[model samples]
Target: MNGANLTLEVLKRYGVDTVFGYPGGAIMPLYDALYDSEVKHYLCRHEQGAAFSALGYAKASGKVGVCFATSGPGVTNLITGLADATADSVPVVAITGQVASPLMGTDAFQEIDVVGLSLAVTKHSFQVTEIEELESTLHKAFEIATSGRPGAVIVDIPKDLQLAEASSKPVLVETQELPVAQTDSIEKANQLLRHASKPVLYVGGGVSLGNAVEELRFFVQSTGLPSVSTLKGLGALDPQDHGYLGMIGMHGTKASNLAVQECDLLIAVGARFDDRVTGKLDEFAPRAKVIHFDVDPAEVSKLRPADVTVLGDFKKSLPKLTTEVDFSVWRKKCIELSEETGFKYLANANNPTGNIDPTSMLNELSQLMEQTSVITTDVGQHQMWVAQHMKFAEPRNLLTSGALGTMGFGLPAAIGAQMSRPDDCVIAVSGDGSFMMNVQELGTIKRFNLPVKILLIDNTKLGMVRQWQRLFFDKRFSETDLSDNPDFLQLAQAFDIQAETISQPGEVTGALQRMVKSENAYLLHVRINEDQNVWPLVPPNTANQAMLEG
Candidate 1:
């Protein structure tokens, strides 16, 4: 068999049944092989869309997602998505076609030093120089991407290699045994948990990335610790659990940030102290002794120093850290704080614009969406609103651009997620500005007849930047207005999608219900006031406790 066919065989062996990409000249050989191959490829309008779709598929399904691109611009276009994958630690393998082997350094047409460009964004990048190295390199790409902490990997193959004769069995790369936390460290953490009157469990995206959600839930249940999650860690703990205090960060809940500040013990599991979560580096969790748990040692004590660290797979370490504790008073305090400071959408406490409140609408959406459904969000006020108001059963059920905060992520991610789990409802909740970023992906949805629902929150402005300017920059709102946004309902209709618009407060439920119940692709265009801002925000350089709730 030739290299192109063998490449497909290797992917099939790795259980990669679907991929996303746009075809180009350098990649045409593989595309030709793909015509008759068992693997399925979903053509995206742009290479960036393909990359995000691959990431979304991997994130939503907990499997290695694959994407393909040609040399030069095709490979360059994928950089943002790859950077997002690296930042978020999602497992994805990207294959790019390169100029012929002989054209190296000669600057042939469509030639690019993609391997050099990818180094900053990917866990590893491999450029195949020989047909003999192709199969093993592909296997190694998958292995490195999925092994510790999960990350994106890239493989660049020259056009000549695709036509070169090849012979190699599909070989699997072996992973080193994951380290267990030292017994003394586990004992140290247990001791901290046992004697502390006030302890808070700090969770992060690493919990779900390590496939330790069940283990984390078990530990939380056994200890009954008051818990708070990072943005990416939202669904790792059961949202319905009384102990869970919702997301804790710049735009996190008041109860969560306040509890973390007041706690005596902060048990950080699978979490790095990101600046967004920590606010002011010196003032965060000032009263707490930290127990840090993570798969990567580099992240441990990288920001906030830990009193004790459990480094290894969370599946093993989380179970060992479970301890008996009595913090009934602290738990009651936290619950009271939640009741006092939790989202009061009914009161219209923050915005008085007399328009449909996105917070209330999303809260209702949380109730109406199925437990297994996936909700992807673009970055802005709506993203934070979804994070603040909605509930998720698993981290996979809520796919957001956490670390990278990339715009145009929602729609393509929704496409990938819906393709990955066709039986489950997938919704792309996008802002007017963000929706326009990858509006072309609507073609992919219409072409595939995908049943993905779109919730376009139109406020006629770049909401988040406008909010920051309004509060921090003396209301000098320059270039944030998007009043020129095209008619969304007509745009969806242009793509042959069913569409409707809703602006009144009473129209939210019916629109959501109809979108959820639709068997075909549907768009729910929602209009809201332009001045609304996400509440409970920790202003720049301030402590998490110094939140502005207006």
Candidate 2:
């Protein structure tokens, strides 16, 4: 057996059945091995697409996503996706083939110091120097990625190692110990819980990342804590729960923003105080005494200082910190606010040109889609609209570029997610500009014949940037226009995917039903007014309480 064979075996043992990647000259040996391996490999048009697909797979499935890339340009192309994973704390293992060992530092072709370029983007970067270290290194990469707060890890294997003789060696997997929460800290948190009349639970993506969604929901139900979510934290709490207000942040629901500002105590669970979540840091949840719970000690007080910090695994910590709370008046107030200011599909006014309101359309789509279906989005107005108006059954159901906000994310991610969860309906909701960013990924869908649904929300402009330009920069709308976009129906047909277009406001439900119920890969081209902007915007550096409404 050669090293390439050993790598596959190691991955299989780690429970990875599928991977996404692109092949290059330096990585040809591994690709050759993959031809007959039990592991399935999907070739993507760009290395960036491969990486993003891996991210989508990981985010959607709660498993460590794996992607392969070869050499300098391939590795560089992976940087953006890695940065996105790093920022979102997604667990992904990226393997890249480096130039052969003999050509080290001689300015060899495609040699750009893969480890050096990726240190900032990965939790750990490994370069296999010796043949014996390959298996162990692969094992370590998976452990590092999944331990504590999940993160992306890179393993740079030199080309020579792929051809080296391989051995089936046994490596002991070390169990990582979780941080123990201090007894006094738990007592203090309980005391805060008992005293806080208007306490709110600020849930974040960490709840899902830590696999503590069930625990979180139980605690929320038991305590009857009024709650708000960060973008990534959207589905952590039941959307229909009495005390649950929708997402909170720049484009969050008004009730969430108002409630956060008015709360007397904030129980932050597995959530960081992000700038997007806290519009104005100084005034964010100002009146609340915070009790922060997280697995990572570094993030506990990184932004807003926690009055009580519980550092430990959430699965263990949530149980000990559970307390009895009575906030009937506070819960009622939040529910009233949510009902008054929440997104209502038919309630929103249509654009003068009769274009569909993205908020209303997304809410309608949310109702149309299966309860188990997954939704992924590229960065822009549509992403904010999805976050504000759509509903997800779980955090994993909404795969998006939350932290990095990468534009060309939706398509490739949908590719990864569909490949992983073939039974579930996966949809990529994108704006015209963001959709064009990685349109070549259409080939990937064609090659696999994967039943991934695409909802191209075209506004003939970079809607988010245009909105900012209109609101902040004198409405110049420069360079954001894409009025000359290719006919999307033809594009999908060229890829052998079914396609349809919808312009009338009345066509939304029927179009959504057709796309969702399609047996093959489908693309739904939705054209709305170019001037439409995401609502409930909290202008930069302002308090969430002072959000600028549409």
Candidate 3:
């Protein structure tokens, strides 16, 4: 068998049912092999789109996503997605076609050192020079990508290698088992949980990636502790759960931030103490004794030193750490804080003509969508609004570019997610500025007939940046104006996709219902006031408790 056929066989063995990519010169042989394979291939409009789509698939399905691209520009286009996956700890396998091995340093057509460029961004990378090493190399890549501390892995295969015949049949490689937590460490963590009066469970993306949501819910419910999550950890527990206090960080809810500030013991589960979540390291959870649990040992004390570090698989650690705790007083205080500082949106009844309030609209949309619906968003005020208003019932239901904060992530991500879970209702909630970043994916949607409802919030400016300038820069808006935006409804119509424009408050609910019920791809362009901002923001260098609200 040839290397290309062997590669496909290996992917199939690893249970990769779907892949996203754009075909090009050096990768033709692989595409040929893909044509006859049972695996589904989604041809994205661009290489970047292909990479992000793969990322979205990995994020939504807890499975290692795969993407293919040719040499040079194809590989270069994948850099952002690779970096994004690395930062967010999303497991992805990127396969890039290289110039023939004989090219050496001759600078052949489409030649580039993908391994060198990707080294900084990927968990591991391979330059497959020998056809004999192809199967093992791919197996290693998958193992490394999905194993402890999940991240992106790259395999750059030369064009000649793809065409080279293999001498023997490929064999499946066994994956390494994740390390278990030390019994003493688990005991230490339990001791802290047993003694604390004010304790907060801070969960992050790791819980979802580790497939430990059920365990996490059990632990939270068993302890009766208040919980808060990072942006990527939104759906680890149901938003309506009494223990959940919404997201924790810069745009975290007041209840979450205050709880973090006042907690006597902070139990960090699968969540790294990133700068965004900890505004000022010296002041963040100042009085709390930390108990950190993670699969990666390095992150245990990388930032905030842990009083007790349980390094192992969350699936094992979470259940063992579960203990009965009486925190009635702490829970009541948290409830009071939530009631005092909880989000309060302006009523739709008071909306003036022509200007719609985004908060009210998001609240309404959240109610209309199914509990199991998947919502993907680009980075902006709309993203924050969705995080605040939407109620997620399970992990991966709310997918966004958390660590990287990539602006163009929503549309392509939604495309990938819809393809992964064909029966689920997928919605792409994007700001006008974010939507335009990779708006060309509308073509991909139309081409594939993907029923992704695009809910575009057009505020006529870079809302997040403008809000920052207004608050911190003496109201100097600078070049943030985007008032001359194109008509998004017409843009969608140009792709032969149905679209509607809504500017008034009364038009929101009906338009949303229509868009959700539409059988075809649809875009509902919502126009709103440019001045609307995401509140409960923690200013740079300030403590999370020092939040500024509208």
lDDT, candidate 1, at 42: 99
Please, what are the lDDT tens digits per residue for candidate 2 over residues 63-122? 899999999999999999999998899999998998999996788998889889999989
Error of 1 at 85 (Å): 0.9
lDDT of each: 0.91, 0.90, 0.89
Q: What does candidate 1 score on TM?
A: 0.98
- lDDT for model 3: 0.89
State which candidate, 1 or 3, has the greater lDDT: 1
Give Cα distance to truth, residue 518, candidate 3, Å: 1.3
> Which residue pairs collide in model 1, if any?
none
Which one wins on lDDT?
1
| Pairs in clash, predicted candidate 2 | none
Candidate 2 lDDT at 172 equals: 82
Identify the superior model by TM-score, candidate 1 or candidate 3: 1
For residue 424, model 2's alpha carbon misses the true position, in angstroms, by 0.7
lDDT by residue (313-385, candidate 3, tens digit) is 8898889986577897888888788878777766565666567888788888888888778899999999999
Candidate 3 residues lying further than 4 Å off, grouped into runs, are 167-174, 347-354
